[model samples]
Every structure is written in C-alpha cells, then in structure tokens.
Target: MAKTVLVINSGSSSIKYQLVDLESGEGLASGLVEKIGEPSDGHYKHEFNGEKHELEEPIPDHEVGLKRVLGFFEEYGPSLKNSGIVAVGHRVVQGGSVFPKPALVTDKTIAQVKNLAVLAPLHNGPEATGAEVMRALLPDTPQVFVFDSSFFFQLPKYASTYALNKEIADQYHIRRYGAHGTSHEYVGSQVPDLIGKPAEGLKQIVLHIGNGASASAQISGKPVETSMGLTPLEGLVMGGRTGDIDPAVVFHLIRNAHMSVDELDTLFNKHSGLMGMTGHGDMREIHKMIAAGDENAKLALDVYVHRIVGYIGNYAAQMGGVDVITFTAGVGENDEIVRRMVAHKLSPFGVKLDEKKNDTRSKEPRIISEPDSKITLCIIPTNEELSIARQSATIADQGDSYGNTFTK
Candidate 1:
C-alpha cells in the first residue's frame, strides 16, 4: 500500500489543503475554503481526478474548515483508510531562524513558533493556531513544518546583510530572509533536470508571482540573493503589500499627517501596491481594463512589468550573468502578456522567448526560449506543497539528517 501525505496551508481568512500519494507524488484530492468568519455564506471548492465540486457552507473558523476537509477524505478518499497516511506537512509561513528545516511538530515547537508571531504578524499567529487545532483534532498523525524561509538561509553575508550596525543586526536577527522559499527550492532543484546540466554550477533567477510576489537569484544552486528583505513587504510590488517604499515616508506621515504607527503599518501592508496604484489588484481585471483603453490599467501593467524587468536585470548583474531564467506562480506561468513583456525587456541580455511554447500550459516543464537564445527561459509551474510533502516524508521515514539529505 502507498503511504499518503496531507499538506495544509492555513491563512488568515481560509485554509488550503491537498492529499497526495507519496509513492507517486500524485494528488488524490485538493481543495480550499474561503471567507472565514464572514457572512454565514462562504465558498468551499474541492477537486479530485477530473471533477470539481463546490459548497456554499458557512466556515466560521479554521477548525470548522479543517473538519470539512477531513470529511471529504472520509467520503471520497480512495484506498485512503487502507493506505495509512505516514505524515502531515504544513506550510508554516514564518519559521524565523529557530528551526532551519522541516521539523516534526511538537508542543515545544508550537510554542517557539508562537513566540515569533510578532515577526510575522500577518501569518505566523493564525498559522500556529491552525497547527494547534490540527494537533488536537488528529493527535495520532505525525506532522512536520516546512518553512518558507528555509531555502534562503544559504544567502551569503554580503547579499543577506543590511547596511546597519552589526551589533543591532545580530541582536534582532535582522537580514534578508526571503519568502516563498519552498517554491524557490523546488524550481531551483528542477533547473538541472530541465536544462540537462548540474544546477550547482549555474546562476539563475526565479520569479514567483501570484497574489504575493518575490524574486531570488541562485548562485551555484543556492540562494545568493532575493528581493524580499526582513518582511514580505520589501520586494517587488505585490497584490496589496507596498514593496520598496521610501523609509522616510513613514516618518513623514507620522510627523506631517499625524498617523500612528499601527495605522501606517496597515496602510502599507494592506491597502497599497497595485491596489493602491489602481483600484483593482487582480491582473485579469487589469488586463480587461487595459483592453478597454483605461490609461490607469495600462499604467499599472507597465509598472508591474517594469518592476519585474528591473529585478531581472539587477539579479543578473548581481550574479555576474544568468544562465537560466524561470517564471512560476499564477501570473508567471499563465499570463502570456506579462511573460512576453518581461522577456522582451530582457532581450538586451540575450534572453529570447519562443511565443509558440509560452502560449500553452502543462504540468511538464516547457522551454519558452528560442532555440538560439543565449539564456534559457522556462515556464515551470511551482509545486510548493509537493515539495513540503517530500520533505516531511523524508524526515518521517529516514529519522535522521543523513538519511534526509539523500532524498534531496
């Protein structure tokens, strides 16, 4: 019988989950529940095989949403009971530096994660609550946490450090701890497979753009630099988070506008970004408005692509030159317009796009570069959850770091 792994990604307003057969790395079921604690009406979407189902049920809490997910397995999981699930993997948004890798969940670990809640106010607190609820509801299940920061730990001192007093930096553990690490790791690992050369000897840039966006440059298969700094708000402009803003803007607002710290925090982290520049943050909506000749929508698209192009150049320069460039996440993989525009901007560096290859989407890795392009361009759909599941299984089955390293 094949062992299974359940991966959970809990957010402030929803819970996303997937059940996969570890032996084959195939998803048996995946779903999400949205609008927690809102009006009595909410949405639950589940997909299995080729079928999708939806429910208009109230999910007032993460615990309730979790229970619904378990219920789905009870009703639809094929060979689920007979094939014992070996472990559960959780996508913990903030792991800080306390635990560098996926760890078997314990009360002590939970406490430690909670203590770092202040560092990731928007994520760790609620994520820990969901983990706690999981431990209570499924006491017998072995669990592991896969951090989004783990992959960036390899950043060199020069790339990771901020120009501050070394003493203060060490005291607060302040550094460029990049986010979306699981995705970065997955893509980095696959570069060798896709290009048929060792990733260890190449320098590449990875763009992970969805609701949250980030960029990282990998030197010799390790993260050498990334856009997101101490927090998720420091990188390329995202759906809502203001990225790379002037520091003086905060003090200016406080002194000139009399805004409190809390108010300023909420404004930048929540109300800014593409949504701040334009009323809508969804790229699809922005594209529609652009087609209808809205100058603001066109401007937003220009700014977004420009920001991405700027980072590609910066990372390329930082790493000397990029051998391979990849685009993943929602906009990166599916939005041909954005992909083409970004690739065009990088043409100066010998990056070329094969329009025919980029217009299609598939599970398999596809080359989006022209045959004679100097640098390779690829569209790789990221699988962060699968990467987490793989990590969890390795730790559970091997029981030691030496054995765990084999799988990687």
Candidate 2:
C-alpha cells in the first residue's frame, strides 16, 4: 500500500485539507470544512473518487471542527483503524525568521508558532489551535509545519528594509516578510518545467491574486522583492483586506477622526479593500455588479487591476526587465475579466493579451500573451497542499528532525 500524507491548512474559520500519496503525488481525498462556529451554515465538504459529499454539523471550536474531520475519515477513509497514515503536515502563516523551510512539528515548534501569533494575528492563532487538537487526537501520527512566509526568506536586503530607526526596527524584527510563500515556491519550482529553461537564469514575476493578492519578483530562482510586506496587507488590493495604504491615513484616523488603534486596525484589516470599496469581496460578484451598472463595483475593479498593473511595471523596472509574468490563484486562474484587464493595462510594456486564450478555462498552463509580446504571460494554477505533503514526507524520512512528536 502507498503511504499517505495528510495536509491541513487551518484558517480562522475553516480548514482546507487533502490526503496525498507520497510516492505518486496523487490526491486520495481532498476537502474543506467551512464556516465553523455557525450551526446553520457550517459543514464539511469531502471529495473522493470524483464524488463530493457535504455534511452539516455544529462545530463550536477548532477541536470540534477537527473531530468532525476525523469523523469524516472514519466513515469514508479506506480503514478507520489502520489506513497507512504516515504523516500530517500543516500550513503555518508566520514562523518568524527562525524557519526558512518546512520543519517537522514539535512541542517547541507549536510553542514557537504561538509566539509568532502577533506577527500573523488572524492566521497563526487558529493554526496553533488546530495543531494542539491534532496532537491530542492523533497522538501517534507525526505532524510537520510549512511556513507561508518561508518563500520570501530570499528577499534581498534592500527590498526587505523599511526607512525606520535601525535600532527600533532590529529590536522588533520589523522588515518585510512576505506572505503566500507556498504559492510562490510552487510557481518557482514549476517555472523551469513550463518555460523549458533553467529557473536560476530567468527574471520572472509571479502574480498570486485571489481573496488575498501579492506580486513577487524572482531573479535567477531567488526572490529579490515582493509586493506584500511585514503583513499580508502591504501589496496589491485584495478581497477583504486593504493593501498599500499611506501611513498618514492611520494617524489621521486616530487623531482627526478620533479612532482608537483597535478601530484603525479593524478598519484596514477587516473592513477595507474591495469589500470596503464596493461592499462585495467576491470578485465574481463584484464583476457581476459592475456589469449591472454598479458604480462602486466598477471602481473597485478598476482600482484592483490598476494596482496589479502598477506592481508589474515597478517589478519590470527593478529587474531591469522581466522575461516572464505568470498569474496563479483564484482570480488569476479563473477570472477572465481580471486577466484581460491587467494584461491590457500592461500593453504599453510590450505585453499583449490573446483574448480567446485568456477567456478559456484550462487546468494545463495556457499562455495568453500575443506571439509578438516581449514578456511571456501564462496561467499556472497553484497547488500548495501538494508542496506541504512532499515536504512533510521528506522530514518524516529524516526522523528526529523535529525533536519528538508530543508522545503521550
């Protein structure tokens, strides 16, 4: 029997999970448990053997959510008792500067993740909760952690720095630590195969646009710069999160508007971006609203694409020039309007959009750049769970790397 790796991406309100065969790199089962803590709208959607099933249940906490997950496996997995489960891997958003790569999860690792919660307030908190629950439920199984900020570990010193007092910034470890790293790493690994060249020899820009968006510039397989900084909010406009706002605006809100720090933080982190701009965060709905003559939706779409175009241009200049520009994630892979709009805005840079190709849906990579365009444009869907599972299996083979898994 083939060994299986269970990958879990614990979020504030949901968990995205998959079971992959380590040797063949094939998904055995994959699904998501969404809207936890709400009785009416919460459920687990499981997909296996080309079939999907949804079960409604009340899950009040991460522990309850995870128990429901295990219940699903008990009823659906090959064997409830012995299914050859080799390892479990988690996607941790912030590992601080300590972890440059995926590490086998340990008690120390869990504690370290907890310590870094302040860095990624929304992500690390739930991830640590999920880790603790898994430790209790699956005591014998090994768990590994893949840091979301690990890919930006390659950010050049200049791009990573902020114009702040050296002492204060150093004490706080305040520098750009990019997010959506697994997606970037997946793109970087696949670039050589897709373009038929050495990855280390290319100047590339990866636009990972989804609910959360970011742009990263890679020079010779190393990340020199990225749009997201310090937090996930420092890049291109996103669904429900504000990106790249002037610092003065915060001060004005605090002093002139009499807003508290907590209020200011929530304003930018929760109630800003496309949601704040148009009252809709889902790009598909925003696009629909625009077509239906909603001015706010139209403006949000314009601003979102404009920000992406600006980043592409800036990265092109920073890299001297860009050889290839690739788009991945939700909006990049499926949103035709976003793809065309962004490519059209970048036409002045000798990047032309192939309309027919841009409008099509393809699981395989499809280049939407005009034949004569200088910059190659393509869409490559990201697979982060597969990346985590592979990393976990490698670490599992090299036992003792994560100390001992919390032995009961």
Candidate 3:
C-alpha cells in the first residue's frame, strides 16, 4: 500500500521508465522500449525483482510502445492498477528558460513546451508526442515534467552568456542552458552525504559522462558553470556529438561541402563523436579496439578523457578551489579505465584517485581518492528518475521548491 511514482524518459525512438517507492528509495520496476516504429524490429525489455523479461513486436508508434510498457507491468509484476501511483514524472530534455522547476503538465504547459522544440528538436518534439499519448491514456493522473536543463537556470551570467550581440542573442533566446541538470544536482547534493559533511561547505565538480556527457561545477550546492551550453551538443565530445567545435564549421559545411542545414545537423549530432572518430560509440567496444592496437580507439579514449580532465582543471580554477570531485552517469560510474586515466592525469591537482577504490565495481557511492589527497574524489551514481520523482512528489504534497533549483 505504499505510494509510488512512475517516471518516464521519452526519447525519439525509446522510452525508459521506472516505478519507484519514494519512501524506500527503491525502484519497484524499470525497463526500456527500444527501436519503436523501426522498420525492422522493436524491442521491449523490463526488469522486476531481479528478473528480466523481453519481447519483440512491431510497435508502430510511441503510443503503442507506451502501452507495451504498461502491459509488461501487468504481465511481470507490481501492477500499476493497485500500486497507488501518486504522480507520473516525465524527464524532459529541454525546458528552455521558461521553466525553472518541475511543471505540473497542463494543456498550456504542453503548448509552451512545444514552442521550445526549436531549441531541442531531437528531444522536445518526441517528448511532447509521448506526453500527448500519456495524457490521452491517463487523463486523470497528475503528471509533472522534470526538465534536464532546469538545474542550470541559475548559472552565473558570465558562464551562461555568450560574447555575442545581446540584442540578437536575447531575441533568439540563445544562452548556455546546460543539460544533464538532474544528474548534476543529485550528485552534487549526494557528495556531502558521501563525504560526511554539510553541502554548504563543498565546492564540487560533477562529471555526468555517458553516451551524452556533461560537466558541472557546483559551489555551495548551486551551479556556477557547466560544460553543456545552449544545447547538449556544445559540451564534451560525446558518443555521437561533435562538442566544442567552431561555429563557423557549420557554415563551412553548408557552403564549401554543399551540405544542407539538415544534413549538417545530422552529421554533427549523429555521425560525429567517438563513432565518427573511431567507428564505435560504446566505450566497451572502443576498449576492445584499443586492446587490438587500434590507434583511432586509443586517440578517441585520449580525446575523451582529455576533454573531461580539461573541464575539471578549469572548474577548479573557476571555483577558486575544489573540495571534492565526483563522477556519475554511464561512463563515470562504470568505466574503470576512464576514471583511472582522468584521475592519474589530475594527480598534480590533488586528485589522487586510490587505485583500489577506482577499480571497485560496486555501484554504491564511495571515495576513490587516496587517503592523503587534499581533494576528495568519489563516485555517486545518478538517479535522475528518483530525483524527479522526489521533486514531483514534493511539489504535489505542498508546492515547495526543493533546494536543488532556483529562479532568476
């Protein structure tokens, strides 16, 4: 009879979901539906109570894919009909500057989010579609949108603004609205818990590296600067993104290569990054190629870690000093080599990652720095869904803004 929250992360071709009991901080069920509407095949994979279930079916659209997810809940376990779901929290990739906190989804809010699609076409459009479907299916259920960009809304103006014509920039709403905010906020807050100190005393740098990666510098539990800019593609070199590139390259590709705007978009957003450099995006595959003496993979790994290391050093200076450095997300949490390589290079900066702790495979948060290092290093696995659920529940319960976010 415990109350729960259903969290949904809608992607262009996938929906990642979880049902959790907030009080227990335990996920009751979670799964993903991939390749939805793909001409070849669609897949549904679900996990409950340590068991896995999968199915293949022609899911023609997002609605069907969503239905399949709920169906799996019924077929597997933790039937939603009796789970007492208080709210459904959706992870929206871009909320623009309009929303500084999780929003109670309404028709008006949906329209507002749709208008912001221009800033995140690959994400907002699809997310809006999924929201529409969820509304139609669960008309009476209270739904909240947890934006990935909201946590960076208060980034220092100097860090968020670009050196451009303020008039034109303001008109176009062009500013550094960093993404992966939930992860950054969650990890930053958890650092105090991991290190047994109050958050107010911590100046921490959080690395949320995955297929898409970003870095955030949080001072006194708030973001001062972050790597991702106006869009996700502007940050670290990701699995398929050309990050930190010269803007003129777009014009060059369009004029010199005779590529259209859409082609260049796909090229930079989809065909670039690790795969573009080394022909594979998954880190595990890249490691295999590296072991086989693939120079491209080796260079890719170097380039990847180099971006991360540079950001850590820059953040340390930007914050005047750093007390802790934390890693989260896919690569930061699991890739032992990545953590070690970055830490080894940062030894001069008081980042002495303990070899044994760095290699520990457990997902629990723990310090990875040497006992005598001046700066602390640890791993805090991000739970964005739970963060969203907590935010949503808090808002629904008393309309209180969790200290994690602030407005201009």
Candidate 4:
C-alpha cells in the first residue's frame, strides 16, 4: 500500500482536491466539487485511472460536499481507508502573519484562520470551513493548512512594509502579505536544480502568471520582494484586477461617481485589468481580438506585458542581479507571446529568447533562452497540490506532537 496525501483547495463554492502519491510525486486521483451551496443541484466530478465520474445533486454545504467526495473515492477506485492516507492538506489563501508556514489544523488554529478572514473576506472563511468539515469527517487523519501567503511571510521589512502611519499600520497589520506563494516557492525551488546551480546565493525571479498573477524575487530560495502587496489587488495587472492602481481612485469614485466601497471593490477587482480594457480577460481571447486589429486588445496585451517586464527588471535590480528567471502557472507556462515580448523587452539586460526554443510547446521544464544569454530563462510547471502534499506529509510524519511548528 503506497502512502498518499489528500490536498484540498476549498473555494467559496467549490472544493478542488487531489490524492497524491507521497513517493512518486504523482497525483493518483483528482476531482472537483462544484456549485456547492448554490440554488441548483451541486456537481461533483471525480477522476481516477484516467476515468471521470460525475454526480449532480444538491450539496448545501462543504460538509455535505466533502462527504460525497469520500463516498465517491470508495465507490470508484481508491478507497480512502486502504490507500495508506496519512494526512489531509487544506489550502488556506490568507494565513496573514499568523502562519509563516504550513500549520497542523487544530481548534485554536481554525479559529485563528477564521479571525484572519477580515483580511481575505472572500477566501479565508470558506477555506476554514472546508478544514473544519474535513477535520470532523476524518478525525484520524492529520489535517494541515498550507498557506498561499506563507512564502512571503518572512519578506524583508522594507519590502513588506507600506509607508503608512506607524500607529495605524501597526493597529491594522497592514503589510504586503503576497498571495500565490505556494506556486512561487515550488517553482523557485526548482530553478537551482533545473539550472544546475547551487542554491546558496542564487538570485531568481519567479513570474507566476495566471488569471491572478504575481511576481517574486528570491535569494537562496527565500522571498525578498514580491509584486503583490497587502492584498492580491496591489500587484501585476491580472485577468480582471486593476493591480497597481492609485489609491485615490477609490476616493474619487466615492465622491464623484457616488459609488460605495463595495461597488469600487467590484470595479477594481472584477471589472478592471484586461477585461476592463478590452472586455475580455482570457489572454487567448485577447490575442484573437488583437489579430482582428482590436486596439483595446492590443493595448491590453502591451499593458500586461509591460507590467511583467517591469517586475522582472525591478526584481533584478532589487536582488543586485538575477541568475535565473522562470515562468510558471497558466499563462506563464503556455503563453509564448507573453514570454517572447517580455524577453524582447528585457534584451537590454542581456535577456535573449531562442525563437525556436520559445516556440516549442512542452509540459516538461525546459530552457527557452539562448545559451549565451546573461540570465537563464526557463518554463517550470508549478504543482501547488504536490507541494502542499509534500509539506503536509513531512509534518504528519513528525508525530502527534507537531502542532504549530513553522517551517523555517
């Protein structure tokens, strides 16, 4: 019986999970529970051994949804009880400053995570709900929380701090708690090995470009600077996010447009970015519009690429120099145009993209930069679920005493 870890990412209305083999680093099974607590019947899909099984039924809550998930595993292929499952890992989006690394799920920790929901109202609450449901449903299995902001928790004060009033900032804990850290950490860790270099003093920049994108600068595998700030909305222009916008725009909208805080929030977070510019958020669709000579689409592409290039240069300067630059996540891994534009823009920094190499589509990590290029450019697919599983398995093996031990 091979040991495995179940990784769960609980969204507001969905629960995405994967059963990963601990020794092989392979996802043995994966599934999604969707439309949870919705008016219509919720959907459940489970995939294992290359077969997919789906169910459509009312799932009023995370508890009911997760119960159906366990039932599916038993009915389909992998029996949870016989699969040598060691731990259940939950992805918590906003651990805030409370969790610097993955923490074992407990009554107190669950409360702490829920308390931090003030910071991530849309994410943390539901993630905590999933954890609570899983802990109760599988009391024998160790439950671990892998935070998306954990990697940037130890960022240098200058990088994490905003120049806000000291007393107010301290009172509110306003600082850059970057998101997409699990992906960054996982991709950053792969750079040294992929580049055949030592991790001792390597300076690397990880561009995690997806629907919600972010960039990070790491030294010796630790984050020093990242694009995302106090909230995920303060960084790179994303699918529908305004990214680095002037704060006064909020006040202006409130006063001039008579918009409420909720309306402004919706505007910046859900209606801005590429979507706001071209009425499309997906990069592929934007590219199609650009081909049809849509000025808005062209401008949106330029803006997106411009923000990414700016961050690469900024991270390089902040780290003194960059040894390796890796692109990961959805757009980062698949979008050759974005990668090409960014590399071309960075040509002044001796960043050269090999046209043929960049054009080649590969699922495996490969170099897309020329050999003589000053900085190494490569594409490394990120596996956040596998990362979460590995971390959770390590902590689970530390015995029953592993409580709040933060990974340094």
Candidate 5:
C-alpha cells in the first residue's frame, strides 16, 4: 500500500478535501461538503477512481459534516483504515506571527489557532473546528496545520512592516502576512527545476491569480516582498475585494454615507472588484461582455491588467531584477488574454510572449515566453494540496520534534 496524506481546507460553511498518494503526488480521492449548519439541506460530494457520489442532508456542524465524509470514504472505497494515511493536513488561513510554519496540532496549538481567529475571523475558527473534529475521529493519525501565511512570515522586516504608529501596529500584530502562500511557495519551488537553474541565486515572481489573487517576489527560494498585507483584502483587486484602497474611504463612508463597518466590510469583500465594476466576477463573463461592446467590462479588464502589471514591475525593481515570472491558479493559468495583456505591457522588461504558446493550454507546466525574451514566463499549475501533504508527511515522518523546530 502507498503512503497517503489527507489535506483538508475548511471554510466557515464548507470543507474541501483531498487524499493524495505521497509517493506519486497524485490525489487518489477528493470531495467537498458545503452548507453546513445552513437553514437548507447541506451537501456532500466524494470522488474516487473517476466516479463521483453526492448526498444531501442536514449537516449540523463540522463534526457531523466530517463524519459523513468518513462514511462516504468507507462506502465508496479507499477505506481510511486500510489506506496508509500518514497525516491529516488542515489549511489554516492565519497563523499570525506565532506560527511561522506548519505546526503539529495539539490541544494547545488548537487553542492557539482559535485565538488567532481575530486575524482571520472568517477562516481560522472553522478551520480549527475541522481540525479538532478530525483529531477526535482519527486519534492515531498525525494532524498538521499548514498556514497560508507561513511562507511569507520570514519576509524582510521592511517588506512586512507597515508605515503606521509602532505602538498600535505592534499591539495589533499588523504586518504583511500574505495569503496564497502555499501556492506561491509551491510554484516558486518548481521554477528551479523547470528553468534548469539552481534555487540559490534565482530571482522569481509568482502570480497566483485566482478568485482571490496575490503576487510574491522570491529571491533564492525565499520571499522578499508580497502584495497581500495584514489581511488578504490589502492585496490585488480580487473577484470581489477592493484591494489597496485608501484607509480614508472607510472613515468617509462611515461619516458621510452612514455606512457601518460591517456594511463596508460586506461591500468591499463581497460586492466590489470585478463584480462591482462589471457586475460579473467571472473573467469569462467579463470577456463576453467586452465582446458585446460593454465599456464597463472593457475598462474592468484594463484595470485588472494594469494592477497586475504594476505589481510585476514593482516586484522586479524590489528584487533588483527578476529572472522568471510564473503564472498559476485559475485566472493565471487559463485566461490567456489577461496573460497576453500583462506580458505585452512588459515589453520594456523584454518580456515577449509567444502568442502560439500562450494560446495553447495544458495542465502541465510550460514556458509561454518567446525563446529570446529577456525574462522567462511560465504557466505552472499550483498544487497546494500536494504541497500541504508533502509538508505534513515530512513533519509526521520526523515526529513532533521536526515541527517543534519550525515553531521556535
């Protein structure tokens, strides 16, 4: 039997999971459970061996939702008892400064994660709940919490620090703890192998452009600067987030518009970005609208491309120079138009996109820049689950001692 790791990403009302074979880096099974504790019926779907099974019922809490997941695993196949599960990895969005890397879950660490919920109120609580439930159910299995902020935790002080009052900033633990770090770290690691360069001296920028986008600049396989800050909302304009907005806007809305903080939060996090500008968050829909001569949609694309190109140039300069720029995640991988526009804007940097290569699509990593381009552009699919699994398994194999070293 092959050793496997189960990676779980729990949200406020959903749980996304995958069981990956550690040796092959292939997901043997994956599934999702959604709508937990909602007024309506909850949903569960499990896939294994190219087959999918779904169920709808009331899932009262993470415990119940996870129980159903295990039940499905038993019924469908790949019995957890038989499968060689080395560790259960949970994706915790906010590790704060306390957790600089993935940590082995314990009663104490679980409490610590819950406390950090203040930083990621919408994410860490549910994630800890899921981890607690999984720990209870799988008493013998090692459970690791892989943090989204971990990869950027070691960022230079200048890059992570904010230009705010030191007293208040220190008290609040406010700094640039970037999101999508697992994706960025994983993609950055692959660059050395793909580009036939050593990791030590390479300068790279990774664009993880998903529904929630973030960019990072890595020098010698370590992050120096990243787009996201104290919270994910501080980064690139996302599907619904009004990223990098002036802080005064909050006070302006509160005093002039009589908007409550909660209302502004909802507006910025849920109603803004491409959705706010074009009335559609999906890029594909935006493209269709642009084709239909919708000026708003066209302008939205321009703004989106502009923000990305700005970050690329900013990161390049910050790193002194960039050798490879890799695009990953949903938008970065599939949306060639966005890539084309961003690449063309970088003609000054000698970024020459191979039009033919950019048009062709593949799941595998490939170079999208012309052979003679000054900077190499690549589209590498990010596998956060595999990255989490591998990290989790390493810690598990070395026992609690390995994880303790990282925590210190």
Candidate 6:
C-alpha cells in the first residue's frame, strides 16, 4: 500500500485539488470546485481513471465547497481511508517573509496565513479557510503549507525592492514576493535534466504563462529575479491583472476617474489585462474572437506578447545572459500562436523556434528550439499539485530524508 498526499490550492473563488501517490508520482484523483459562492453556475469537476464527473450546485462558501469535495471522495473511488492519505498539503499564495520553506500547518500557522491576507487578500483568506475545513473534516490527517513565495523568499534585495520612500516601504513591509513559486521551482529544476546539464551551473528563465503569468530568472536553480513584484499583480500581463502598469495610473483613476481605492483595486486586479483589452480573459476565446476580425482581441494578443517579451529581455539582462528558457502553464503548453509570437520576439536572444516543433503539441515535455539556438527552448507542463504533495511528504517525513516519493 503506497502512501498518498492530498494537495489543495485554494483561491478566492475556487479550489484545485489532487490526491498524489508519493511512491509513483501519480495523481490518483483530481478535481476543481470553482465559481464558489456564486449564485449560479457553480460546480465541481472531478477526474479519475480516465473518467470525468460534474456536479452543478450552489456552493455558498468555502466550507460548503469543501463539504461537497469530501462527499465526492466518498461517492467516488479511492476512499480516503483506503487510499492511505498520510498528509494534506495546501498551496498558500502569501506567507510573508517569515516562511522560507514549507511549514507544517498549526493553529499559529493558520493565524499567520490570515495575518498575511493584507499581502494577498484574494488568496490567503480562502486558503486559510480551506485549511481549517480540511483539518476539521480530516482531523487526524497532518496538514502542511507550501507557500507560493517560498521559492523567491531569498530574492536579491536589489531586484525585490521598489523605488518608493524607503521608510514608508519598510514600515509597510513592501517588497517583491513572487507568486507561482512551486511551478517555477518544479520546472526550473527539470530544465537541467531536459538539457542534459547540471542545474546548479545553469542560467535559466522560466515563463509561466497562464491566466496569471510571470517570468523568473534563475542562477543555479535559485531565483535571483522574477517578474512579479510585491504581489501577483506585478510583472507580465495576465488574464485580468494589469502587470507593470505605471504607478501614476492608480492615482489618475482616483482623481480623474473618481474611482475609490477599492474600485481601483478591483479595476486593476479583476477587470484589467486581457479582460480589459478584449473583454475576454481566456486565450482560447480571445483567439476565436481574433479570427472573427476582432481588432480588440488582436490588440490584446499583441500587448500580451509585448509585455512577456519585455520581462524575458529584462530577465536575460539581469542574469547577464540566459542559457535555457522554458515555457510552461496553460498558454505556454498549448497555444502555438502565442508560443510562436513569444519566441519570434525572442529571436535576438538566440531563441530560434522550430516552426514545426512549435506547432507540434504533446503532453510530454520536449524542446521546441532549433538545433543551433544558443538558448534552449522547451515546453514543460507544470504540475503544481504534485510539487505541493512532494513538499508536504518531505515535511511530514519526520527525520526520514528518504521519503521514497518520486520527486518529479
């Protein structure tokens, strides 16, 4: 009987979860409950053993959503007791500066997660809620927290600081704390193996392009700089995030547009980026709209690529030069058009996209760069749940370094 870990990634309105086998590195069961608290169109979709199921119901809150999740596990295969779940791991978006590594969740840890909600309001509260519910439902199961910022917790100060009033910034604990850290950490290390080189000696850039996008520069498997700053809203353009916007714009909206601070926050955090550009946050829909002669969609695509190129160029410069570059997450793994567009802009940086390879799509990771391209270009699908599970098992191992879980 192999040990399994349950991984949960709780967001403002959703929870993505998976049960991963530590021995095989396989997701035995996975699902997502989204549109949480919505009056309508809320549901959970579960996938297991090549089968899928959907339940449409009004999930008034995280507690209700989690209750339904447990119900599904009982109704579905792989019973929790039979599955041998030894630990539960959570993906917390903001752990502040206190946690530089994955932590065993406790009452103090839950309180701290709430304390940092000011840093990631949309994420931390919901994550904390999910953790509390999980603990109550599975009281015996040890819960662990794997922070999204832990990967870049040791970021170089020069790259992490803002040019604001030093005293004010320090007072508010303002500094760059990058997000999507587990994905970056997972894929960044895989680069060396894919390229047949040592990870510690390589200079790399990881582009995690999805609804929420970011770029991270690594020297020897450690993050030196990343696109996201202080919060997930910084760096590259995202589905509904205004990344790298001029700071003056916030004040401009407040004074000129008469938008309140909360309104401004919602504007930048929820209604900006591709959503603001083309009135759609999904890339697939944006592409469909673009095919129908939608100029706004076209502009959104251009701006999206433009912002990504800017970060890639900057990261490359920050690292002096980049040896390997990877594209991961939703858009990077599936959208050929976006990949081609991104790689085209990066031609100057020795990222020569193999057109056939760029168009070729597969679930397996593979290089899409030309034979002689100086920078190795590849597509490595990110598995954040697996990453969290691995970290959780390690944290729960209790002095056993050889946890036997497949690290991948």
136 Cα displacement, candidate 3 (Å): 2.5
Q: Rank the candidates by lDDT, best first.
A: 5, 4, 6, 3, 2, 1
lDDT at residue 217 of model 1 (Cα atoms) = 93
How many backbone collisions does model 2 have? Answer: 0
Residue-pair clash count for candidate 6: 1
Q: Highest lDDT: which candidate? A: 5
Candidate 4 residue 131 Cα shift, in angstroms, is 0.7
- Candidate 6 structure quality by residue, lDDT tens digits, 1-408: 889999998998999999999888899999999999887978899888888989987888988888888888888867888898888999999978877788877777888899999999988999999999998888877888889999998799898888999999989999999999999999998889888999876999899999999999999999999988888999899999999888999888888999998998999988999999888899999999999999999999999999888888888888898898899999989999998998888787677889999898799889999989988899999989888988898777652222322221
Rank candidates by TM-score, best first: 5, 4, 3, 6, 2, 1
Supply the global lDDT for candidate 3. Answer: 0.87
Which is the winner by lDDT between candidate 5 and candidate 6? 5
Q: What is the lDDT of residue 345 in candidate 5?
A: 95
Candidate 3 per-residue lDDT, tens place, 136-189, comes to: 777766777889999999898899999999999999999999999999998898
Query: lDDT of candidate 1 vs native?
Result: 0.83
lDDT of 6 at 351: 72
Candidate 1, which ten residues in sequence have the lowest lDDT sum? 399-408
Better of 2 and 4 by TM-score: 4
Cα-based lDDT for every prediction? 0.83, 0.85, 0.87, 0.91, 0.92, 0.88
Worst 10 residues of 6 by lDDT: 399-408
lDDT of 1 by residue, 296-380 (tens): 8888789888889889889888888889999999888888899999889888878789988888767677888998998999878
Per-residue error for 328 in candidate 3, Å, reads 0.8
Candidate 2 lDDT tens digits, 1-408: 778888898998999889887777778888898887775768789887788889877778888888878887877764425657777889999877877777767777788898899899989988988888887888888878889998898788899999999999999988899999988888877877887778776999999999999999998878988998888989899988889989999888888899998898888987899999988889999988988999999989999998998998899899999999999999999998998888888887788888999988888876788889988898999988888888787776675444543332
lDDT of 5 by residue, 1-408 (tens): 899999999999999999999999999999999999999999999999999999999989999999999988899978988899989999999999998878898888899999999888899999999999999998888889999999999899999999999999999898889899999999999999998889998999999997899999999999999999888998788899988889999999999999998899899998999999999999999999999999999998998888998898899899899999999999999999999999999988788999999999899999999989999999999999999999899877675542452232
Off by over 4 Å in 5: 400-408
